[model samples]
Target: MKKYRIGIVGATGAVGQEIISLLEKREFPVAEARLLASANSAGRQMQACGNLETIQETTADSFKDLDIAIFSAGSKQSLEFAEASRQHGCVVIDNSSAFRMDPLVPLVVPEINPDDLEKHQGIIANPNCSTAVALMGLYPLHKRFGLKRFIASTYQAVSGAGAAGFDALENELKAQFVPEENSSTATKDSPFPHPIAHNLLPHIDDFREDGYTKEELKMKNESRKILGNPSLKVSCTCVRVPVYRAHSISLSAEFSQPVNVPDAKAAIEGFNGAELWDLPNANRYPTPLQYAEKEDCGVGRIRIDQAFDNGLSLWVVGDQLWKGAALNAIQIAETLVEKKCLKWM
Candidate 1:
């Protein structure tokens, strides 16, 4: 077996930490692991592959000895360091929105487009968290029944906003029991414009003039690219829920061919990275609590949509930090390995 040196940017953050754990958990033939983060988090220590690795500041020099680099930092970090890593003869699989829509970079979901790795110009882009979860259900159906369009409403977790968002939700939940005098200390600084303890925020990212947010737009555009459906009509409403992890999406899709409940359930069950959990009569369906931290996305509530002639309605849930971000990025690398797409190797 061949082992490759790997580097994880933003090693101190939530998604970055998951990347570290997953690399070891899934055993991706890592010979060496380098943890890189901002200067402030440089000296931090993290456990990986049963050893404590020291975090280093991310710079151009970070990738010289690495075979693969996974970027879990924000777009700014990816934009600044991704090309530099690629220039160092390293393949970059990015978790940010940096190069997803770039014609040159391959926007991949390993289950949907693993073969696309062959054309990567040293960088691969992971889909949006919500888009990734939605596709786990939609893509399989698209294969069985040609998909026409989809409308989705996502109940995203606070973890999607990162650790700070998690803290905000935690603090607010604690503040509920605190007296008014000390409540300010708990619910003071929040990443969301509104409270997320028990309430919901329909907005996820910056709003556009068309009344859609950037996060909403990501689901539309990214889905089309991954599915190879440029004209695919997608409308999504993104919401932030108080959950600590995982994301749930309510999807209604129109397909070219007629869709029935049994065939739809069969498609989901047979798909890789997706499990059919529909048993509403038994009071079972995919939920954020059920799918959190699990690798497979769960799809349930399959039914024929009355709104469209050949349409279906379903619910999908997945761990955003895993299938949505870290797991997906790692899968890209695994696909590259399996397909022998790593040019540097």
Candidate 2:
């Protein structure tokens, strides 16, 4: 067994913390784990692989000695340090939008596209939280029935926005004294334009000229790329809800072949990293709270779509910090190891 020296950029963030915890939980052959963050976050102590480690300020030289680097930092850090990490002979698995659409970088979900790891040019991109969770339901179906298009409505958690978003929701929930007539009475300081404690915000990310938000478009664009189906159409509406950990998506998809509920359920059941939780009699379906902190995304409410011929409607839920970010990034590293794509190989 070979253990590799690893570096985790943005080690102080919500996703970054999850990455560190997952690395220890999964026991991926790690010889050393260096936690890196901003200068302000430097010197902060955190636990990783059973030892309390000091967080360091990330710089160009951060990856000089690491064999693999999993970046949970946002796009700015990824764009600035990813190439530098790669140059240092470290395989960079980036969990940001920085290089996902880049023709050169492989956008991967290990269960769906592990072979794509072989095509990496030092850096690999993880898909959006909603995209990754939704795909856990859609990919198996796509294999059973050729996928053509989908319409998705995502109920995203506040944690998806990171710690600040979580705090904003938490503060508002605690500050509520009276029932305000309007939901807009929410704190103006919230990261979201509206209060997420009780009301829903139909917007996620910046809105585009085409009326779809950047987050919604990410589902469409990233899905197409990962599925290798350029013609696949995705119409998505992303909403921010009060939940604090996982994300849930409602999907109505039309496929080329005729689909049935039983087979659809079976497809999801047989898929890796996905669980079939449909039990209508028991009133069971995938929910964010239930799936929070769980590695496997849950798919339920499987049925034939009423709107489209040869279509199916399903619900999917996954932990935003886990499969959506940290777990997926670590899974990519595991895939790299399994595929022998590391430097030693």
TM-score of each: 0.96, 0.97
Model 2 residue 186 distance off true place after TM-score fit, in angstroms: 5.4
Candidate 1 TM-score, C-alpha based? 0.96
**Candidate 2 C-alpha lDDT tens digits along 206-262:** 999999999999999999999998888999999999899899999999999989988
Q: What C-alpha lDDT do the candidate models reach, one value each?
A: 0.91, 0.91
Question: How close is each model in CA RMSD to the real structure?
Answer: 2.3, 1.6
What is the C-alpha lDDT profile of model 1 across 1-345, one tens digit per residue?
Answer: 999999999888889989989998999899989999999998878788777889999999999979999998899999999989999989999999999999989899999988778999898999999999999999999999999999999999999999889899888777673335423232566788877776778989899999999999999999989988899999999999989999999999999997888888889889999999989999899989999999999999999998977999999999999999999999989888888879843
- What stretches of model 1 exceed 4 Å from their correct place? 177-186
Q: Which parts of model 2 are misplaced by more than 4 Å?
A: 177-189
